[model samples]
Target chain A: TQLLEQSPQFLSIQEGENLTVYCNSSSVFSSLQWYRQEPGEGPVLLVTVVTGGEVKKLKRLTFQFGDARKDSSLHITAAQTGDTGLYLCAGERAGGFKTIFGAGTRLFVKA
Target chain B: SAVISQKPSRDICQRGTSLTIQCQVDSQVTMMFWYRQQPGQSLTLIATANQGSEATYESGFVIDKFPISRPNLTFSTLTVSNMSPEDSSIYLCSVHGGQGNTGELFFGEGSRLTVL
Candidate 1:
């Protein structure tokens, strides 16, 4: 089975603090995606990183893909209360449409 | 953007009972996905709902416990049978990819169920 492991399962920081989450795997992926989910709601897509070494920025969040397509990371700059959520990373296999997800990183940004 | 909605946004059910959740997508989508999230956990894929075809379930899941249906491209339903306390979770429906069909996926608000 292909597994994606997320580090630092829990994080809490005051407003304006910075944090980074990592997702690593032993298998290569055709594409990788990041999502943030709030309480009582489904996950919302943050970014999709397909190519190795690719990076995408959305407001205060920056997502990066590993050079080997086996890992990804999400960095939050000047975190806020609105950034408090569970961050997830999912990867799609090359020859199939099936996807695998990491355990997750729960971030709490207190104001 | 393809907007997806799941019925019974939240429900409290008794043990041994069953509940069927409905998912509706505003636009025609090629792939409709079902996921389950336990408290403080990441989403786990239950199955892939295909139009006019039988749903393909993943390992650790059984067809008898979770029966799925997709009669058309824009609609699908998932039924959980013989509910137990452990069955309580948030069920979400997601559409794979958007316009031009990148690897991105769009999700519904989700159905939250608590089995008492």
Candidate 2:
């Protein structure tokens, strides 16, 4: 049983504040993906990090995969009100048949 | 990227009744998955619907309670039988496109069920 644990289950920050969320797991994964889900909508893929020590950026959002492939992080710089959403981290097994998701961090950025 | 659509976007049903949700994809996909998301919780994989075989359910999930049907490459259905209030949640249909399992999954606007 593989599980990914996420931190800061809830967060509320003023506009222009920066924040970082983390996802850690005891098991190794072949690839990790980040997703953002707003209210009343399914999660949308933000980025995918396939290699250990890999980093991918989408606009002001940055994602990093740990060197051991057991952890990952998402950093938002100068966060805006639009960045408010539930951020989820998912890890895919080597065969890509099984994927496990983290609990997710719900961020609320006030304007 | 594939576009996915789910029918009965939101439904309020009485307890002990059944609800069948339909998922349609614009293009053929290699894999289709069903997930349940409890309020303020993460997505839990319920089962993997194979194109021609019986759906493979994850641990804690059984085929009898949540039966799945995948008749072709682009369509699937999930029926929640004998529902209860605890069963009220968002059900999402996801698909993996591209060749040979190289692509990420695309999700449909989930079907939200509220059992009263």
Candidate 3:
């Protein structure tokens, strides 16, 4: 079974602070995706990284895929109150449609 | 991107009862997925529903406890049978975005069930 382990299960930070969350796995994936879910809503896709060592940026967020495709990271610069939500990392196998998700990182950014 | 809608956005059910959640998508999709999520947690895929075929459940999930029906390309239903307190969770319906296997999913608002 493939599992993605996420670090810092919970985070509380003041506005304008920078934070980073990590997701690691032993199994290699064909692609990795990051999602943000707010209260009472399903997760929304933030970005998808398909290549090893690939990095993608969305406004104040930066996502990185590991060189071995076994891990990923999400970094938020100057996080605002709007950034508070649950962040999840999902991995897709090379030849399958199945997607495995991490435990998720709950971030709370206070204004 | 496809717009998805779920019925019974929130419900309170008694233990031992059953609830069937419905999912409707604006566009026809080849595959539909069902997921369960505990509060403040990540999603766990329950099964994959395909039109004109039986649903494929994950390792820990069984068809008896969660029966799924995909009568067509744009609709599906998931029934949680003999529910218990542990069955209280948010159920989400989702479909792949665009064409091919892009690894991107668009999800519905989700049906939140609370079992007493």
Candidate 4:
């Protein structure tokens, strides 16, 4: 079974601070996606990175996929209180039939 | 964008009782997914529901404990049988539908179950 590991499982930061979260794995994935979820709700799609070394920006969030397709990262610039949520990374295998998810990083941006 | 809705947003049931959660999507989707999230944990795929086909469950899950049904392309149901305290968790329904069928997955609000 393939697994994705997320680092810094818990993060607490003040508003306007910058934070970065990492997702790594030994298995190579054909595509990777990032999602943010709040309490009592389902995850919301942030972005999907399909190419190695590719970067996608969504407002203040910047996401990058590793060149080897074994890792990914999400960087938030000038974080706001609204950014406080659980961030998850999911990867799709080459066959597109299976997918694995990371443990997720919980960000607490204080106002 | 596909809007997925799940019924019984929150419920408290006895340990031996069973609960069935319903998922409805705004649009017809080819793939419907069910996931479970333990308290303070990540999401785990329970099974994949395909229209007119038996659900494919993951390694740790079984058809007896979690039976899934997909009556059509836009609707599915999951039933948790003989529930225990360990079965208490948030059940979420998701779909693989987006612009041009991208890899992105959309999720429902989720059903929170408490087995006491």
Candidate 5:
């Protein structure tokens, strides 16, 4: 079974602080996606990185895929309270349309 | 990405009773998936609902415990049979992974179930 492990399962920071979360896996993937989910809501797509060593930015958020396609990272700049949510990293496997998700890093940005 | 609308946005069911959640897509989707996220846990794929075939369940998930129906394209249903308190969780439906992509799952608002 393929698994993606996310670190810093929980995080709390003050407004304006910057933070980074990571997702690592031993298996290779064709694509990787980042999602942010609020309480009682399904995850919303943040960004998708396809190429190895690729980077994609969405406003204040930046996503990077590992050169080997076995890892990824997400960085948030000027983090605000509105950025508080569960950040999930998912990998799309080869020939498999299913998206496997990481355990998620819960972010709580205080005002 | 596809827009998926799931029904029974929130439900409070009694133990031993069952709840059936519905998911509908705006267009014919090439893929449909069901996922469950227990409290504080990651999203876990419960099954893959195809347009014409029986749903394919992931490991640790069985048809009897979580029966699913996909009568045609753009529609699917998942039934939590003989529910229990531990079965309470958020259920989400997704489809149309991505454009010329291997994976991209657009999700619904999610059905929140609370079994008491």
Candidate 6:
């Protein structure tokens, strides 16, 4: 079975602080996606990285797919109270329709 | 992107009872997915519902405990039978964004179930 391990299960930071969450796995994936979920809501897609070493930015968030497609990272710059949520990374294996998700990183940004 | 609506946004059920969550998509989709999530945790795919066919459940999940029905392209239902305290979790329904194999998924707000 393929599993994605996420680091820093919980994080609490003050406003304007920078934080990085990492997702690692031993198996390669065809594509990786990052999602943010707020309380009482389902996850929303932040970005999708399909190529190795790909980097995509969405405002204050930067997502990176590793060169081997076995890992990914999300970096938040100057995080604010609005950035507090659960961040999840999901990967799709080659030739498979199943998407495996990481345990998730709960980020709390205080204003 | 697809819009999904789930019924019974939140419910409180007693042990040994059953609850069925309904999902409706605005647009027709070939496949709809059911996921289970504990509070503050990531999603776990329970099964994949396809119209006119039996649902495909993931490992560790059985059809007997969670029966799924996809009568058409735009609707599906998942029933949690003989519920227990451990069955308390949020159930989400989702569909692909029509971007092919590696496309993103759009999910409903989810049905939060609390079993006593």
The segments of candidate 6 whose C-alpha lies over 4 angstroms from its true place after superposition are: B101-103
Which clashing pairs does model 3 show?
none
Candidate 5 local lDDT, A19-102, one digit each (tens): 999999988888998899999788988888989999988899989999999999999999999999999999877566678999
lDDT of 5 at B67: 93
- Docking band of candidate 2: medium
Taking all chains together, each candidate's TM-score versus the true structure is 0.96, 0.96, 0.97, 0.97, 0.96, 0.97
> What tens-digit string does per-residue lDDT give for candidate 2 at B1-116?
78999998999999999999999999987579999999999999999998989999998999899999999999999999999999999999998745543436779999999999
lDDT by residue for model 1 over A1-111, one digit each (tens)?
Answer: 339999888999999999999999988889999988999888888889988999999998899999999999999999999998899899886776877888999999999
* Two-chain DockQ for each candidate model: 0.76, 0.68, 0.83, 0.81, 0.80, 0.80
What's the lDDT for all of these models? Answer: 0.90, 0.90, 0.93, 0.92, 0.90, 0.93
Highest DockQ model number: 3
For A1-111, candidate 6 gives per-residue lDDT tens digits of 329999888999999999999999998889999999998998999999999999999999999999999999999999999999999999887778888899999999998
Better of 1 and 5 by DockQ: 5
What's the true lDDT of residue A108 in model 6?
Answer: 96
Each candidate's chain A: what TM-score?
Answer: 0.95, 0.95, 0.96, 0.95, 0.95, 0.97
How does model 3 fare in lDDT?
0.93
Second chain alone, TM-score for each candidate: 0.96, 0.95, 0.97, 0.96, 0.95, 0.96
- The recovered share of true contacts, given per candidate in order, is 0.72, 0.54, 0.79, 0.82, 0.79, 0.74
Is model 1 an incorrect, acceptable, medium or high docking prediction?
A: medium
Clashes of 6: 0
Better of 2 and 6 by lDDT: 6
Q: Encode model 6's per-residue lDDT on B1-116: one tens digit a residue.
A: 88999998999999999999999999999999999998777899999999999999998999999999999999999999999999999999999877563658889999999999
Better DockQ candidate (2, 3): 3
Q: What is the TM-score of chain A in candidate 3?
A: 0.96
Better of 2 and 3 by lDDT: 3
Q: List the residue pairs that clash in candidate 4.
A: none
